[model samples]
Each structure stands twice: as structure tokens, then as C-alpha cells.
Target: VRATQNAKSKMAEVMPDVPKKLDDWKAAADTLDQGGQIVSLYHQLAIFTRPSEATTAEENAKVIWRGRGFELNNDTYMHRQALMACLPMTLSEKLHNDMRRMRRVSRKTVANAIHLAPVIGEWRGTATPTLILAGRRGQLMTLDLYDNDQGNFNGAIIGTPGSGKSVWMNEIAWSYRATNAQVRLLDLGRSFEKLCSKANGQFIEFGPHSPINVNPFTVVDDIDRDMAMLTPVIAKMASLSAPLEEVQYKAINAGILRVWRAHGKDMTITALRDLFKTGTLEDLEIHNDVRIKDLAIMLEPYTRNGQYARFFDGRANIDFSNDFMVIENEELKRAPDLHAVVNMILLYQITQDMYLSRERGDHRKKLLMIDELMQQLGEIGADDPVKARVVEEAARRARKYGGSLITATQAADDYYSSKQMETAFQFADWVFLLRQKKESLELLDRSGRIVMDDAKKRLLTSLRTEPGVYSEIYIYSPMGEGIARLILDPHTLLLFSNRHEDNQAIDQRRARGLSIDQAIDEVLRERSGKPS
Candidate 1:
């Protein structure tokens, strides 16, 4: 305080403008209260002066110090008779003091300190072509797929049940649909019906008796690559508990090659099965131990006279031309025995389409959202090479093509428990961690997907489990990793709503022959009329 007063006095003597600056500060202090006096503080100095013929800058500084009644010592203490500077400890002090370090501040202050703009991770200045509104901070956040030049835009949405994982994904699909991006959902829970209907997308439902043609043998152009892609899928479909023997793999390969050669555009799973059933196994050069008969017997159910033969006997019923498409497996959800095979086939088909779209130079951005991925992952072994290859291939295609994948499940441990699932997680550039179980939280804390400090981990661990519009999440991406609260727009919220009353109202309005927009308006009106 005394040093500051001395400096102010010295400034008053040397400069005429010092008095007016002091007066302005005094006026500001007076406006606050009677006890509010501005105390100017100074420390750490390097003296500089305009050159004068009368004295050097060093001598002038010494004169100013002496005039302020500061004492100068002898040569023993004062190394020079020139200007001296002091780097006071206070001037270099850090803001994180013991008393305030542990306290919490307002979100605004935290946002400012971290430069957390009220925008998405990819928002620089101009709007991005493929990003969608993820959630809100101070404003809406747009999630960019092609970020960091990685050319891969894979993501994972992990949380416990009722944590709004499905809702967030629905919002993403809606946003992309708004921008004319090709959006597809490999939906397990049948949660995308309303959203698909709203978007006028192809809603292809598959069931035990539903005659939906999904021919896996339709992949024929690049036989080797297509055969390689279907290997895991066929293994999964056959409910192969263990990895296929080398000869068994080769047998399946030979059968597929023959089927493609014979059928060409008329390729079907029935024909593929017929090729194996010709009883010409030894002629195909397969090893004695690897029975083509065994594979053909397992695949008999998907043949012409079998239970699922109706679905694979004809050409593919669903096309990928729609902007939004949902391939829902409602029956398989109840039949856990079929999820592995069915999902594998479905995903492999999508993979083929992704490659085809890129090959044909389709510039439209694509998204493949797989909901309840854990169900499918649960059926496959942890270290299954076939599943691993499928995952690796998906990640690779995401890079080659401009498509992004968003896979959601109940827990992070579900992915971590399996090598195939974990590979997919590692390949994902963006990770959205919603309200998680304590066990999943521990796994994620130790995982490489997101590096969180103690404070961040604590915040994530203590997140409220209640689900709503503001579905709290901590997103880890290339731009930065931090907590975000996502709130959907009213129309999107209505289109993909999981609320019981909202669904009832929508159904009622639709039964009255109202259009989707009119149904949404009616629902919104009814909701607004209700008391808060």
C-alpha cells in the first residue's frame, strides 16, 4: 500500500494526466458507497524513459525514487547506480489460491474461462454443411461428423436405460433429415416409427411371418470382398457358438463364389444353400473335417422351405434411395436367438450400401444409427475374429466414404467386455456419455475414449439420473470434451417423442385424419393449455 501511494505521488509529479486518472477512479468509488475508495496497486517494474539531453533513463528513475523518499544503499547492496527493477512475488501470483480453489463458480464464468462458446464443437464462424444440433449450452451445439480431418465420423452413445440415448439419436436423425442427408436406423426397439413416418422415410419392418425380402446374396459385383463381408454375418446367422475352422471358412467361401457364379443377378440365400446341398462337398476340395453338409444343414432354416426362407428367397424389398430409412426388427427383439444373425446380415448389407454409395460418387452425407447394440454384441464372442473384421471394415469404410456411424447401448462395459465392441468404440471420434451406472462410469474413467480430470469425472459421476428434455451428457470430441445439456426443438421433440401422453395425443390426432404437422400442432396446443 505504501509503495503504491509513493508511485502515485511520483506519477503526479512527473505527469500532468495522473491527477485526472486518479479523479476518475475516485468518482467511480464515490458512486459505489461512502467506504469505497479505489486503491491503486503496482508491482514488478522495468523503467523506460524518453531520451533527454539532461539525464539518462537510469538516472531519471533514480531521481524519481529519491524524490519519493526511497533510500538507496551503498555499492555493496546496490550493484549499480543505474535504474533498478523488482519482480515482486505478488505480481506473478496465480489465481488458484487455497481458499478459492475448491469453491464453485457460476457456469458463465466457467464458460468464459474455458472459452466455451454457445455453439457446437465444429462451429468456427461459417455454418457447416453436415453438422446437426446436438444440444444446448448457452445456445444450440452443432455436432460435425468430418472433424480433425480424420475422415472417419463414428460415434457411440452410452448410458443406462431411461437416460435418453434413444431420444438423442432420434434428434440427430431428425436434424440430418432436415438437411437432406441420408439417414438410416438399424432399430431394434422399434423406437423410430413416428420419426420415420414424420420424415416420410421407408419403414421396412421384419418379423417371423412378415414377408420382407432381405437377400444377403445380393452382394455379387466384387465377389471376394462381398464374400469376405458376409462370412461373419453367415457365421452369426448359423448361430455358430465358436469361431469357424479354417476349412469351414474356406468351405463357406467356395459355396458363395459358386452361388454368385451360377445365379448372378438372381442370387438368393436359397440358391447359396442349394450350392452347398448339391452333395458335391469332396469335389469342392474342402478339408475332410470341415463338412459343407454341416453349414448347409444349419442354413436350411433360411432356405426355400424353412422358417425365414420367405425373407431371403426374393430380391431385397427395401431400397436405400430414401433420405430417411428404418430397418426395424421388432420380432427379433423378442427372439434373442435371431438378433446376432439378423443384425449381422442387416449391418453387412448397410456396409455394402455405404461402399456402393461412395463408389457411385453419391455426395450425400450418410449416418448409420444402431440402437441397442449391446443386444447384438451379447450374442457374439468377445474375441471373435469375424466380428472384429466386420467392425474394422465398418470403421475403414467410414473413413473412405463420408458416412458417420452412431451406435448406442446400455453401458460402456458392454463394449469394453468385447474386443469387437471395444474396437468400434476406439474407432469412434465422438463419445456421448449420458447418465451411466457406477460400474460403467468406472470403466469409462479408465478407458482411452475420454480423458477426464478429477473434477470432470466427479461431475459426470454425480449427474442426476432423471431424464428429460435437458438430457445431460458429457461429450468427448476433437474440439474439446465437456458437459452439455441437450434440448430438442418442439417439432423434433414431438416427432421422436417417447412420452406416453404425447404418444397418446399423437395417435388420437392421427386417428382423426390430421396430417403430421396438424397432429403436432394439436398436441402442442394441448400441451401449452395444460397448467405448468
Candidate 2:
């Protein structure tokens, strides 16, 4: 209190004629508050004083504060508040400017941060992951997005025949070249050449004349892993055809197991065949004659020349000379058994290999992209035991082994009828629905309980304006992220910025090495009705 009184006494001595009017003192105080510091406060007060009234009094007051060594600490809230109170209008302007500047800086910082962050990983632990292409407009597009690493993915891409399905697949294939992912394409239509070229990956064609034609009777070692899948089914079928006696059925099953075990620990058809050719019924411990007969018949197509003879013979005669060979022979035409056997075997082998790869801690992700998957489903009727087992096993192992099986078709209903398809769908952690036909969409929507009405309405509205380019994509991932919708635009085919740049580079290369000027001239000339 003594210091405060002394300070006030000195201030009064320096400003003997200081403003006594309340209004003048309030105005000066307002200016001092905004200025913040004692020096700035005194300067602002002087500026507020009228020129006609710029007497020694105001000058003396400023000198007094300066000489007294008065200071305002900006860091203190109370001091700042006092400063602001002294300069209300100036404080308001300064606060407004400061907020605007801060907002601008924040926006720029956020944009830079997003740009620096790499895209999210789509397939967990996979360096080379299978990319999901969403149909945007008329082109197949992919977003620079990834689902959480929960061992599942959902993707939907829709387009007509020429709408770039193959192109999109090619792009995805190429994207994984640098990673440890392997792609096994079951392309009925050989459209992955460009993808193969860009990724520098090998393409094995599995059409007719391929040495890997399906055969259940052929020795497993020489057999295409795909064709070997039918052995168990054939054994089962043979048992079903026998008498209804339980003893006979059990015996048949035992004989089949003997054959399976005879293949040794590896469990292949070749071992089974060797066992039948060398081992006696006593060796197999088969007490029932009916079981032996059934087993012999089951082996006949593979070992003897009969109705199913060609199926086994074609596979046996295939030149094991090449690691990969095409089996294009008339025998394949008459041998439906061979076709079924081969496809099943291939599916089995691929799945097993994938599982083994996982066991070894190999980080290479595998993708089985099946176009016209419905056709394969159709071949294996719902009642077919072999189809059911293979599909179930494949679906189950696919997730466990860090592999994915993508099935694409024109309509979901055609494929959804099979119990196997349903099982596979349930196991599939992700589902993608592209621009489907109205009926097809309704069927899927109803089955999945998606809001079909709103989707249909929006789709119709978009289509009327954009024609074939407009479509919708719905994705569901296993991590409970649930469904997400996106509109497809043909203009942006590839979603990632890097992928887009790569496509642009490819386009430029395909332009026949024309200079920019020449290309522009060609376009202009073409538009002007001139021949280039």
C-alpha cells in the first residue's frame, strides 16, 4: 500500500494538469488498454488527444509512466484483460485478424499432412495386395483406400463386356508387382496379357491341349493338382452305387481310405493307384467282396479302357515333359469326367499351395480372380458331394492363408442358388455390388437386407443423366466397417494417384511416339476433316 501510494504520488507530480474529466480519462484509458504495454498505452493516449488539446498535461502523463518503469506482462490473463479493456475497438480488430490468420495456417497444415501420409494398407501383411476396382463412370476405378487389417475385404465393380473389366484386372495385377503377392488367374478369356507384361509375371494358359487336363485315375504325381480333386468323389460315388448294406458301405469306405493311405503321407492319387496295382485285398484288410468290386470299378476308369477310359488315358498320355502344357485333344471333348477332375484338382492344388505358403510365413498374398465363376458353380450341382467339399475347403483356407478368391458374374442369383455359393458368400468377409440389373439388384438387396428403394431411385436418377457411365458400388469388410457406397465415374478409372500416373505413362507410350505438337496437330486435323 505504501509503494502504491508513492507511485500514484509521483505520477500526479509528473502530470499536474492530467485530464480530470471522466469522459476524456475513459477515452485515454481505452486506448491504453489496447496498446498492451505502458509505453504503447502512453503513445496511443497521446494520439487520441486532440491536436488543439495537446497540452503539456498529456505529454507529462506519458513521460511519467515511461520514467516510472511501468510494464504490462502480456502472458498474464489479468494483465491482457486490463490491456484489452483500455483499447476495446483496437483489441476487437486485432483478435479478428489473428483468428483469420490461424485458420488459414491450420488448413494448409492439414492438407500437407494428408499428402505426406501413405495410403492405408488394403490386405494386411501383404506387400503386393489385390486391389479393388470400383466402377466409376464407364471405367473401372479404384480408390486410394484400404480396409483395416482384419483378414477380410469387400469390393464391387460392375461394367458391360467392353466396359474395362479386363483392363481393371490388368491394372490391379500390375499394382502388386513390387509386393510379395502372387496372382493365379483363372481367366477363361485370355485378357491379362497387358497385366502380365507390366508386372513381368508368368501367365500359364489352362485351355484344351494343356497337359494338365483333368483325370481322376491318373497317378497324382503326373496329374494336374486340379484334376486330382475328383478321386475322393469318385470313390464316394462308387460306394453309393453299391448295395445298401452298411457292411458293404463301410468296406467301400475302408478300401477308399486304403487307397488314400497307400499314396503315403502326401496322399495323392498316384500312391492310391500304386497300392491297387501292387497291394492285394488282404493287404487292404477288405473282408467284403462287394467293397472290393466297388473299389475295382472306381479304379477302372483310371486303370482300364472303358466309358471313362478316355478321361484317365488323356491325362496319363499328357507329356509330363513340360512344367506347364496345354491339353487340347479330342479326348477332352468326350471326357466330361476329365474336365471335372482337372478343374477340381487345380482348385485343390492352388488352395493347398497357398496354405503351405502361409505355414512357411511367406508374406506373398495370393488372389484367385474368377470370371464367370457361375459357370464353375453350375458344373458342380448343389447335390454334387465333390463340388461342395472343394468349394468349402477352398473358401475356408483362402482367408486363413492370406489368399482371396474373387468371383465375378453378370448376375448374383445365377450363382447364389448353390449352397456352396452361399457358404462361400458367408465366409467372404467382403461383398461388392456394382451396377446390377434391376432384378438382380432387387434379389441381392432383398437377400442382404440393403435399402434397395433409395439405391434404385438414386441409380435411376443418375443413369438418366449419364447413360452407361453412372453406377454405384457397395463394399462390406469383415472388420464391421459395414457397407459403404460410391458412385462410379468413367473419367477416373484408376483411383490412386500413382496408379493414375502409371496409366497416363502407358497411354503416352501407346501413342506411337508422336511428339506433343504432332499429336495435337493430328487431333486438330482429324477434327478438321484432314487425314493424318
Candidate 3:
């Protein structure tokens, strides 16, 4: 009130205008008179630059400030004062006196002053950050996918095709490997092949004419546990238009037990199907009914002499010996009917391996990354309740056994498409949302999940991706939601590149007796025509 009475100036002085400053002061004085709190605000910035690039740095600063409708002062004389003000716990008497005399300040009521400082928008991730990223304003924001008090590292990555989600998530899975975490990828389109190779990981491609195959019938534990685990995969194979009936499930269960009794630890779906063909469940009082015979025809495609036999019925050939394994099913993904059932089988088989790994060694942290997850989740869940439970349990059991379940989808609704899918999504404490079409955004709005508000929804629609540069994404977790840019360096880009030409280049160099790193470097050098 005293400053407002005596220090009223008529001219528009310095930076923030004089008459407007007095108006602000009058408001503060009124608040003071009414016994409300009045507060003062001050700000300082110190930009460090090379002597050669000082002018360029100053212009960049002007561009940033001008975007916010503020003019830059370029006060060369106050450099020392600026440095002094910015250094924490180093207040100088001379700088304080100079600030008092200069009137380079703003005063407002407490409510207004609170917004001026002490409220940094950036989220500082956990102490040991798994992924480092940059906020929109170039502030440093990071992600602590593991080693945080949040209790679970499960998360999702959602974006439209060509939105750079593959590269972004490949980088994340790569980063987790740095922490010695075991990583496995269930992928479509072979998005993880390059990185898997780079990490000396197992890359098993499931398709016709492929050397690898997935057999879910192997006995990992007791017969009952293996039976319970195979229940979902078997249900997915037999049921086409509807969920399996109780009688069919019991018949399938009886057939599986007989196969185990016959083959012991070495069993396959072909063996189970053969057992079902014969009327031989007399011991358990579970006779082969007509429904069981109908199931045999449905299960024929997965049998030895059936069409989809090679891909579905064999002993598992891959190993968890390495910390990383990418099980890519591009061919199966193309076959919509087969993709849903195989996905459920793979999810359980991987977790069973996880259980075996726990028994063999220390319970080190592991990561299960499922790419192209949107379509299969809801369809499989609604079609087969048993498979849906297994799918959701894969994510839930990940946290229980010191691991994380990370999935990527095309949109938000796909994550919440079914009750089981929503349950799986609820386990995701961290999520990445990239660019979306306007129509996709509208669907997300109507999906009835309170994911983002109007402003954030607008932000999501405006996200962008550059082919060789950075891609912008909205990162969400229990901590907070903020935008981040995933900018990969040239080498890392080559490691994550799935483009056929780039991959062919890498493969050509590798065929010439080059290591993964050496081949990638050769590719980078060839692209740039400069040795790097």
C-alpha cells in the first residue's frame, strides 16, 4: 500500500510497462488493505554459450521469449547480477542492493505470485531413470520404468502406424537391457529384429518354412499346472465362433491329461489331438463325447498332418539363454484366424519359461514387450474367456515375479476395448501416447476412459514424427502426464530401423563377416559417405 501511494509512475518504463505495473500494484495494495496476502516475484535466467556462438544463442533466446509475447532485453551489463541471482545458496549483498534499486520486479496478490515460481512443469522421474527424454520446452524429463516406488513397471505405447512407436519402444527395451533386465518381445512385422540381433538375443520368426516353432504342450511343472496353463491355448484352438462350453473344456482337459500320461514330459498338440480322436477317457469317467469329436476337426489345423501344423505343433526350439528374445509372428499376424489363438499360446509359454528361469537363477527383473497388441487383445478376450484370463494373467504375473508387461497399440480404445483388456490396461502405470488421427481422437473421447482432458486431447492430435529426426509423444504415468521427444542418434536409429533397404544394407555388411555393431557402423558410414 505504501509503495502504491508514493511510487506511482506515469511513464511506461523498463520491460513490463509502468501504468500496467501501477495497476497491478493497486490490486496488490487493495488485497493488502483487505488483510489478504501480497507477494513480490522475481525471475532470472543465465544462458551459457561459447564465445563464437553467443550471438546465435541470444537470437534463440529472443525467439523463445518473443513466442510468449515478451521482448528480450540483452542487458549485457547485468550478466554478473543474473549469474549471482541464478546460483542457489550464493546470494550476494551487492546484487541484492542493485535489484532493490533497479525496480526490475513484479508485485501481485499471493494467488497470482504462486503461479510465477516454484512450480516447474517438468516431471523428474525416479532416481535411476530407465528412459531419458526432453519436455517440449527443452526441460529434461525422464521415465523410471523400473527401480521406482511405484511397485509396477508395466506400461503401454499407443500411436498410429508410421508414428515411430516401434523405434521409441525399441529404444526403451534396449535401455532396459542396460540395467541387466531380461527382455522378451512378442512382435508382429519383425519390428524388434535388428535390436534383438544387436543385443545378441534370440530372434525366432514363426512362419511357414521357418526353422523355429511354438509348442505350448511342454511340461514346465506338475501335470495339473501344465494342464491349467494349456487350457487357454487349447480353448483358443477349438472355439471359433463362441466361448468353449463347460463340457467341451472338461473333454479337452481329459484329453490333455491322457496325452501327458502317455508322453510324460514330451508332449505336443498333435498327441493330444490323436488322443481325442480315440474314445479313451475311461479312467477319469470323462468319455469322448460327440463335442470332443467336433473339437478334433477344429484342432486338426494344429495337428501334425494339418495345414497350420508346422507353425503350431513342434517342440520349442528357442532358448532363454540370452537376456533378450524377440518372437516375431508376421505371418501369423497376416492370418487373422490364427493370430489370436497363437498370441494367447505365446503369452503363456513365455511366462512358463519365466517361471523356469526363476527356478534356475536369481529373480532378476524381466520385461515382456508385446507389439501390435491392439487388435488381438479385445477379439481374443471376448471370444475366449479362458484365453482372456490367461492374457490378463500374463500381465499381472509379470509384476508378481519381478518383471513388467509392456504393450503397444494403435489407439486408446483398443486398450480399453473389453473388460479383460481394461483390466490389463489398469496394470499399466506408464503409457506413451503418440500422434493420432482426428477420428481416432474422437473415438478415444467416446471410449469412456478418462485418459485426457480437452487440452491434452488437442495436444495428442498435434503430435508429430520425422523420418530421421525426433518424434513427439505424450508420456503418462502415475507421476504425471507430459510431452516428450524421442530423438535417436544415427547409430541407434540404424539399430532400430526396420526399413527393408536399411535392413538389407545391414544384412549385406553382416554377411561379409561383420559384427552387428560393425555392420551398423558400415551402413551409417555408407549412408553419410563419411567415416563415423
- Please tell me which predicted candidate would have the highest TM-score against the true structure: 3
Q: Compared with the true structure, what per-residue lDDT tens digits does model 2 show for residues 31-141?
A: 556762222111123134667875666666667666757432222333444355346455455654554453411212233345433334332222223443433223333
Q: Which is superior by lDDT, 2 or 3?
A: 3
The top-ranked prediction according to lDDT is: 3
1 versus 2: better TM-score goes to:
1
Q: Of models 1 and 3, which has the larger TM-score?
A: 3
Candidate 3 segments exceeding 4 Å error: 1-36, 41-107, 118-121, 226-228, 278-288, 311-314, 375-384, 417-423, 442-451, 511-513
List all candidate RMSDs to the true structure: 15.9, 18.4, 6.2
Task: Supply candidate 3's per-residue lDDT for 532.
Answer: 62
Taking all chains together, each candidate's TM-score versus the true structure is 0.72, 0.52, 0.77
Residue pair clashes in candidate 3: none
> What lDDT score is found at residue 460 in candidate 1?
84
What 10-residue stretch in candidate 1 is worst by lDDT?
Answer: 104-113
What's the lDDT for all of these models? 0.68, 0.46, 0.75
TM-score pick, better of 2 and 3:
3
Q: Tens digit of lDDT per residue, candidate 3, span 20-94? A: 556777776778898889655566656788999988898998898798676778666777767777788766666
